[model samples]
Target: MKAATFFDGIGWREGVVELVDGGARLRDEVPATGIPRLDGVVVGGFTDHHVHLQLVDHSQLACSRLGRVVDLGGDPDVVQRLAVHPVRIEFAGAFLAAPGGYPSDRAWAPDGSVREIADADAAAAAVTEMAEAGASCIKVTSNSVAGPVFTDELLRTVVELAADRGLLVVAHAEGAGESERVIRLGAARLAHAPFTERLDDDQIARQSASASWISTLAIHDDPARAVAIDNVRRFHTAGGTVLYGTDLGNGPMPVDLSPREIAALREAGLDDAALLRALSPVDPLDPDSNLLLLPGSSPAAADPLAARPLTPADLKV
Candidate 1:
């Protein structure tokens, strides 16, 4: 099970991944195996930290070897079942929003997936419900361009409630200064790559210091592609943590590793080291699954859509 390239710390470390009947291991190269042959790295076993798993067709995603998924925004019960199911899923259940805010009217978002809370008590209750339902984190929607946005106060309540419940809060931040607003309040992750607003050096530094961002650049649509790329570029330059996310069910994105999205991240200055961390599955609930095996050579800096397969390599003990 020798892999030509695999994620190690900041960059790819070439190595051999050995798998036994019950466990796995990785070393310098292919070691003598009692078994006659080795499987190539598992394609698609990587974690997608931000995805609308409930909205996606499982078959398409299952086609690739996706080992686990982190549903960024969806119903808690649904996410809970997903977590318990065989797929090895993690989730940030529901979009905590102001009453009647964005996605409340979106055709794609269902009622269960949108939990609207007007004050701290209701926010706390909703937060508890999601936590009890076994959610790994909370997701907030602050997409001002789509509809009414949450007031600073209500957003704070959601953050506070999430903290009380020991869950991280991830936000769909958009429009002017929205990214700053969330980062300032201790949001742990951004569901979408920033697009509508340009962040300054200070702001990028602040976000880098505070939160991780999921890159859904391909869904930005061509008109706003450059803006998304530039936002990610600056964020990466500032040493911000960026996660690879496809927002899978949002549009016509590939159900698996999106080459275009990878290219977009590379264009935005995410070098090989940064790129590997962004794609690795290291979510809290999923403390195992030591490695993500992307078979084949990494894409050249120029071509972004170079990722081919994900292999299930040996787990670190």
Candidate 2:
């Protein structure tokens, strides 16, 4: 066991922890005697909620600050191979889209990364394929501007089938009304903050009640960025859960943590505590949690985004 100052969300407290092969686990109160002590601040594992394994230099992630990453789109085999790379991983196998929906024709999207389900009848086989491929969630697309979007029936079918399999549906909603439809259809998460249009308070309220939005705000420019930020601000204020995501493969952002993404989230009014929550999908205080140790960090939640978790070499028991 090791002892250090730990952050319990609202403030810091002296704590004891056991660093494990996977990550650190919390034990009990701090300032305990007769135990080895690690100097630094301890927090739960950080997860980048949205990423594309086929698009990013994922090799760099082994030494990056993150402890967990969720691949929102990729070839199933590619994503599964990445899961063994030290950091904990969850993935949505491929982008479920209409026959010709977005990313299907994009040069950057490798073949087999987009699963086009033209009819609701194909939904079960699609979900089963991903689930069997070790997928933790299902990604559906509704980008009417790019191509044929999902019919309401198709989206509902996917959502229901995914739910039955105990998976959450993460939707890439880019066109007008697409996000609204995704939210009402019981999708558990939005792949990106809505950037196409500003959401009314009522819509924001409705969204906050059912789904969490991943903040990929830095990927947008101008009107889109501002619109996304505004939507996030209102949604958060309305009690929405915001997950810190970089959309890692979409741009030239850092492979590990993106300061720009953190800045955008700050602009959206997430203070240090909220930022910590965004970084972590599970409570850091739990004994089963994967933890991050930022050496010499005080309890004030200061400069946390700058931390690089212990690399695979350092974390190897």
Candidate 3:
């Protein structure tokens, strides 16, 4: 019987986890058998909801603390091949963009990373390509600040096509009006907290009612970071769902559960409880899944989300 404190991705409870035969079972009392006690806080598996597999040294992921990663943009073939990683991999294939749109010109974007679809017909073709390639969702780029963006006609086209294929559309909504456009066109997720402009209460309310925002808050410089954090705070206040995503592989960022990203989310007013929900994209209370055992008998009370992950061997011990 392993005695440990368990945070079920929401609330904390003192419980004993017994690995009876081959699985962990949570119980309130200690069992009468010999088993190594879990010496730390066991929480739900953490997920980095936004990443780019093409830009990172993915070889390190096999030993990484992350339990899951979602590749927001990458080479479809490369993402497919990397799905065998020990850490669960979910991905959205190639950036579907307007001709001469954002990321088509970015130096870090690898070849086969962008499919510049031009019209409704082209949008359907592009969406079909991604779905056929086994993408969990569709990624659309509407970065009017960087280059040409999708017109309302094209945005509607992509959203409609993606829906027909049973896929959700996640958009890189940037610039003055891009966020509003995509929110209006029904993008299911935002790749980043809208940073370029302060959203009106109505805009935030609309987004809160209709979609979720991924907090890539630490990726920005001071003024933008400040703006993004403010928006996140207000959006969450309005009952908007906030997803903890770092937009990993964007630059000098950690591939693991990023402390800096977690710090920024905390700064944005996500307390331990809200941050716990943000960290776990998948259900943590499942009977079969082994929960994440982080090192430490007790995590920092002031910064509980900063706990470091334990290796598999460490968990067994």
Candidate 4:
């Protein structure tokens, strides 16, 4: 099918892609100006690896140019039901955290969405429950800013349980030193970029050694965005794996490809290739066909516009 590519780094590019069994398969990489003015079906499908689909207006989300979402923190039953739709739903069942941790007080968090665990045994049970309920992975929150965060011992136990269950552990680590703790525990992914504190050399080294950070820079206001950029810069310098994500439902934000988040990544020093890699659905370590396409030559080097902070308008059906 014909398609218009949203080259995340440069401008958008036009091309044709074939969707086989619901996944994109590159058909032909056509030149931008050479895009044939022919008539055919065009599919603009892209995956948002981290999202809280049930919390947001799914109807509004449909307005964005996104094909699917990987719900990082939500109800597994809702996720199971969501999966029956054409827009694929992959997820971590719920937000597993220390008792009285984040999202518990967040007004948007649903009744079953927060799975609070106090100890290692409880953590294991929580992880097992999520798995049995059809979680693609496990999400654990360690946000001291909100309330009591996970203890090192508790975090270790949760990680171990996740490992034993053959599930990837994603942590919502915030507050001083939480990044280091998760890094040391070998978290598979971070729910948000480390915004609470900058990483020390050892911490950065550990972060580089393992773990990937999802970008949710657009959620923060001016000062916070600046802090987030600095944090991301250091992580990038240390060679940490960075993935593009927008905490879609935490507040008002874009439902599709987020340009402001992309701009923040650029400000943090990601170059063309790195930006592409960050936006790419394909894993960088093991290349795959899930590459995003934007139909144009790299745009002229232009002064970066201020962070617009994405809103619903950016998303299109």
Candidate 5:
């Protein structure tokens, strides 16, 4: 319950956190539980901002250290079932795209997982359907690399519809000009840091000012990796919100916190605090009921990947 370093919302400090009624309370003194000493720092549970619940095993994810997840794309029915799982889930029902667009033909994307908007007039209805299905946000695909993308008019309609519904919009922006197009259309977030093209300073500044970009750095292994890293580095330096995400289930990756992804963010100039902020749960969701306990004196700052998420059951009174 005591930690030499504790993340007290603002920063890490020497303090003790007491477990109470499935929540954590910071206190100066607390009775020991007769348990062995835990020489690590404690912090709030981590959230992966982008994942696909339908593509990955929900049970495996719940057992991992991640205490929360934001599923960017999935089938409505399947994703809805996961909402009641142990780990907190904030999901976007499905990938809204043009007919025959990205993920529609992919083997991993199931039927009913990709809703195609053929007309701009249907944009509002599409968003409403997802909202009815319990989607916290709306996800769109603007990936020209795969197939036809939404026309500007349709994209604008989707964004406007989501805004009217009080929902944030996230887009999978790929191919040249896609990132800028998504930002210009007023989407609230990007599924991945723009990797298909290197964003110039102006573009970086504009994207940073307009939308948060999820860091899926570990998904790329070729030359695109450098471009993504540089873009994210500049985006973070420009004060943009960089969320931690691992496009999980897109490839072979760890179900839990990914050390490669964490290291990649670190390489992109996100110091400990910035990295933790990316991992921290977003608002509208209650603070994580669990706590993260590491095994060391907590470095100058916390290494997110090193911390172990602990539930109330894992803690001894």
Candidate 6:
């Protein structure tokens, strides 16, 4: 089928994409299937890097434009079951926190979703349980504002254990000193961009060099929102990897691609190319499985997020 125009995450071009078994490839020529001409640009499907499947209606998410999602924290058994759904999912089985830590007492957390480590000695075992349960990464909490947090030693142990298993560690770091601890402990990613406080330049550079920050910028409001936007902007300027992740299911937010979240990322200083890269999946995540065909000419290069997402079935010749 011919797409009048298309943007393959790099630039705009006109081409006929041959869809094969849920994947697509650009071709020079092909026999017309008598399918009506497609107008507008086609691009890769997007991924929401942070979400809680246990809290949202999974069916609604499956029907949305999102091609894949990374479940940050959820009940292991429930997450495992949902992983088999049509919308691809990469998940961290549960939230590993210090005993009585954040989310343990929260009304939203499901049973068996938050495992509190009793001591540093149990760090390895706890991480192993998550990996064995098919978790893509280990998620740990370092939210000092909520309650008790993992000591440096315990946090270090958890990171090491995850590393040993060839998995990365994503941390929910909030409150004072939490970001510093996450950096010092060598976590590979921050579940949310640093909020609650403005980070100094050196701290921002250090964190940027060490870990990628998921842009949950739309989740914050007003003063705190400005702080996060500044931190992310500096981090991006310092050559940090900014990933697009809306904390879906955490509050009243869109189950699919959030235009507000995209706008926030742009406000955080990400250009069109950077925004595309953030939304595109990396190796093993499979962004090619589905295509986002946007009607009309490509959206302003700087605001590609304004385009809607369309599935392969919607564009199949």
Q: What is the lDDT of residue 184 in candidate 1?
A: 81
Structural RMSD, model 6:
3.7
RMSD, one per candidate, in order:
4.9, 3.5, 3.2, 6.7, 3.5, 3.7
Candidate 1's TM-score reads 0.81
Q: Candidate 6: give the clashing pairs.
A: none
Better of 2 and 6 by TM-score: 2
Q: Model 3 — which ten-residue stretch has the worst lDDT?
A: 302-311
Cα deviation of 112 in candidate 3 (Å)?
Answer: 0.4
Per-prediction tally of clashes: 11, 2, 0, 15, 0, 0
Shift of residue 11 alpha carbon in model 3, Å: 4.0
Model 1, runs deviating above 4 Å: 1-16, 22-44, 83-87, 281-317
Q: lDDT tens digits, residues 99-151, model 1?
A: 88888888998558988778788888888888888888888888777777777
Please estimate how well model 3 matches the true structure, expressed as its whole-model Cα lDDT: 0.81
Q: Candidate 4, overall lDDT?
A: 0.67
TM-score of 5: 0.89
In terms of lDDT, the poorest run of 10 residues in model 1 is: 35-44
Tens digit of lDDT per residue, candidate 4, span 1-317? 43333333324445444445655444435635644432222222455678888877776544455555779888788866763233456789889977888888887898789888877778878888898987878998888878988878888888888888888888888888787777787688888888776666777777866888888888888676777788788888888878778887777776767777878888898865576556543221111323333323333322222112122222222
Model 1: lDDT to the true structure: 0.69
- Give candidate 2 regions above 4 Å deviation: 8-13, 17-26, 33-39, 281-291, 310-317
| Predicted model with the maximum lDDT | 2
Query: If both were scored by TM-score, which would come out higher, candidate 4 or candidate 5?
Result: 5
Model 6 spans with C-alpha error above 4 angstroms: 3-15, 19-38, 83-85, 281-288, 299-306, 309-317
| Residue 299 in model 4: lDDT | 32
